[model samples]
Target: MSTGDGVDEVAEFAALLTELKERTDRSYGSLARRLGMNTSTLHRYCAGEAVPQDFAPVERLAEFSGATPEERLELHRRWLRAVAVRQAARPRTATTTEPEAAVAEAVLPEAAVARTAEPEAPPAEAGRADAAEAAGADSGGEVGSGGGPARRWYRRRRTALLAAVTCALLATLGTLSALPADRSPSASSPWPSSSADTSGSAPARTTAPAAPRPSPTASPNRSSSPSPTPGGDSPTPRTPEPSTSGGTAPGDATVPLTWTADSQAWALGCGHDYVVAQPPARVPPPPAAQDAGPWAAAQGAVHGRETVVEITVQGRSTTAVVLTALRVRVTGRTDPAPGNVYAMDQGCGGSISPRHFAVDLDRDRPIARPVAGNDTGTPIPAVRMPYRVSSTDPEVLLVTARTQGCDCSWYLELDWSSEGRTGTVRVDDHGRPFRTRSIAGLPRYMYDTSARRWTPYQ
Candidate 1:
């Protein structure tokens, strides 16, 4: 659009045409049909038999073919250059002896100057122009043009290992020139792409940008509407995509909402803030992270000291054993579950003892069948393991585990859903393990327990 751009859209248009033919394997007739134009028109353009008067169709077609805004602009500039050359080419004009030839010599590089010099242009120019216009088009790229953007990005991400290995080493090796947004010498005729990409490869043109055009086959109103390309007119995002392994907010319907018990919900990062799906959606009070004793535990039966557990074997064959203990009882009760009653203190509670427990399934199977360990009342932290059985309603239960490194209490809230049931365990809650992290292997794990040993289930 600027005067300094030199050539006009014609040259850029030519580049777009060439790029299209190369990028797609479609035959000429097929391409014409897609453009809603007659094959002969396409042939004339391809064969240099005729020049387009409107230029809209050619530009639009380029857009539909996924050409970028920069490319489109270059095509426009090249077109202008081509027209100026033609005017200069008028035979024996009063002042100009050969305008077209002169303009051609000025715009075209030394290599191509003599080759394309003529009163009439050739088809190959258009083809080459189209491809050249999109020098850095790639399907998955988010940036393009000069290397400024990429270089700045490298500076910011210098600490990132991937950035260092991908940019630093590549540049020192002289392979960086070919990396991201680099402009080729031949691309001077058109405005060079912006300097945003840094992948050390020309940023691939993303999806075609929006344009102002109407297709012959479509209604006038609809066809004439503008189309914008993906990342064409907008700035690229600075941050990397967040890790998929993290937890999602409650509103994500895709995620099974596992509501924590109001009393134990605080341990789930509820605090004073309403985080849990108390009313389901809208905004509910966050579950309380217990600050005092049993009443303020991370995750366990509200009043009782046991809970349910649904276990899914990871890499090895293992079973989830629900060990119950009565924490309120004076002494601890270490008893295995019959169906689902769990406890931490068998002798400590009213009629039971304060306790801790652990369990594992038969060693033969790597992953045990989906089983539900129902209410082994009050699954206390440091006393048992936590595992999930199903992901359907987003259930949560407390299970205990004995790790190789140490014995700690933590909670597990089913981040994802599968054929297995969901569960939550208390980590470092109350008299449990001293450390305070749960969702360990899950990365988002929050550890909340202290020094407490969970014996492996026999």
Candidate 2:
């Protein structure tokens, strides 16, 4: 209560807790609901009526309030002090019989011997018992003149308590010593599942990438023959569109290949299974083993995590189109692309799962468009195209989709022209395209399939 130079630690702690609750702007009911605890229980915590034995709820509440590191640390220290004080105030009672008997049996063989040899006293001894009581009354209830039994019992009990306390302290120190330095007890990391997302708000219109699913076979199957790889001759011909130029045409050799992208039109979902920079292995992790951070609000929006897509052109040519102008669309007019897949436990949960479509230069050929930001389970009505690069240039043409929010696996398709040659590369981003990007393309950091580990893309 004092406003003087000296601080009231208990009052200050209570005030801090109260301030944190107010800052969250959420009613006790809402907080309790999200945390799955009773409102009065949370109230008791904020009121400082009693310090909680477990700090899990406190850590969660701190995260919800978005408390800074310093404030969280201070609050934790306050709780520790309160718990220590409360524990110390409790009265201590010890039963001397058990410990004393054990010590006597171990250290004094004569004590056990005397117990076994004891028998009923004779009638004449009854007179001696009365006389012995009279002497004992004068000696203040001591068993013997020196009170050896009482002294021995007290000494043994004190020693046993001290030994137990020492063992507990040693065990605690040993456990702490084994933990990693960076992973010390703190507010930033309450547990493996309780890490906070400090990435902040991501660029608008980003979707949490889902676990890499099977490649769309619709597009590749439509073509009678296998689609030509990048830098190879295209079996299909380039059918030019009507020329807009007074003397030349839009699709003519004189005009460069053009494409457009409506970046804002693409909507990303908040709930995705995984977000890895590279393609996932053919044997995907089991449903239970998948990382589900995207579903957690505490981890923040999955769209916030950036996925980098890089595009590179190897052969130089004036006929090349703007790489960014291309849009993803279905390859066929009547073919249905793979529908938007929802992550496990995310059905109709307000996540706008993006639809996968084959990327092409043409915009109006039954392309799959992104669904409304609020809708879920909108069937992808277009073709799901695998990752591909098309170009005619003898030199290598490269394109990197340098964006974020890719799952542990994803898809990409690319088409381009160089050196008067048009070639197309089609493959799954989770497969060869993803591997080439790391092996021969650029140097970047990607999450490995291993649990909580990172590996270099070389």
Candidate 3:
């Protein structure tokens, strides 16, 4: 069947599968080994020459290849369409037994009347009739005399019965053809719905149970807590957590800790600064704190001086995940981006007390050190690692990575343990490393809100 795009459903599904496989950068043999399937079988599925009886294998392959949630849902829909097409193309056979029985029932009464009319016959005639019956049985024909009025009547009746049966079969076929083609799965279908758990290891079943609905009262992954201001006794502004859902399950090989990183979170003081390749005249006015990421991208900007990233981590299945440590891996170091310095704001004076860590990117081997908030009057104590996070209780970490000597491209590695399993999850700006360029000697500028124009920083 077509998938509304003129391409066959099976071919579309195969194309998506092949794309995911290629994105992983893993060889077919290695991926097959991890999936516990033959290499040739996977090749056939990706080649559009075959489809799997179960979707579990496909799901596992998708997860291993790092498909997003939306992609996975679309893949499931395509699989359903392909399965429907295959089922419809199968040949169907009709049985003739029921129609033949109906014909027999209709002819029984007439045959009895004919027999009554024909009373006792001569011995020779009876013997001849018996021989005719034997010959008819051997040839699988009607049970009647060889050539007489009765035999002719029987032939006419048989012809009418055959004609009636043929008409009925035609009518049935027409009715079937008039009905709409339904691609949806039937009540008895073995495949699961799109909402089924996508943990990459769900077993195939005849019927999928309803997925558990998320609770209305469930707390968000990022929650705000009160922290002290830089100087005054008043409470500080609540640092908003990154908006994200619960963690995803990474199969049985590692801990089921789900996390997300937001690099655009409030960077207090000069933390929101960025170095754009454009000049002051070409740059747009500074945007709100939340719009910093996109604004910087539009101006072709890179993080300046330091980049403060907010990471929210949660556990799946109500199990607690212990965050052991945060490690920094610097991929490259070079001279800072050559451009004008732009500050997101004149100044953001607030102390952040969320599990804060600091990384000096200029060091050969940078380490994440737990650092206190930037409060001068009273230093907020630093929260240490090994924090427990569950579905009901999630934790947020604010990592401030700074560089003074070089422009650094780096990413974070989070080591976690839960339920006797331990593994590491890499955190970066999507698939690329987070970049922070040193702004040691550049002039800082900010948009003057009162004047509605860009001005040099005081």
lDDT of 3 by residue, 84-110 (tens): 455435543465354544433333333
Worst 10 residues of 2 by lDDT: 258-267
Q: State the number of backbone clashes in model 1.
A: 153
lDDT tens digits, residue span 1-458, model 1: 23333334344455556665544334577578767789888876655444576667666565444444555555555554555544434554456433333434444444134433332323664445444445435443333244434344443543353343445434433531322221121343333575666456433221223332333453211101112112242344221111111112111222222222222322112211111111212221122243322322322222122222222222100112111211111112222221211112212223222222332211221121222322246322231222222222122333322222211233332232221222222222222322211111221112122423222112
Return the number of clashes found in candidate 2: 43
RMSD of each: 27.5, 24.4, 22.5
Best by lDDT: 3
Candidate 2 lDDT: 0.37
Q: For each predicted model, how many residue pairs clash, with residues at least 3 apart or on different chains? A: 153, 43, 1
Model 2 CA lDDT for position 263: 16
Answer with 2 or 3, whichever has the higher lDDT. Answer: 3
Off by over 4 Å in 1: 1-16, 87-192, 197-458
Candidate 1 vs 3: which has more TM-score: 3
CA lDDT, every model vs. true structure: 0.32, 0.37, 0.64
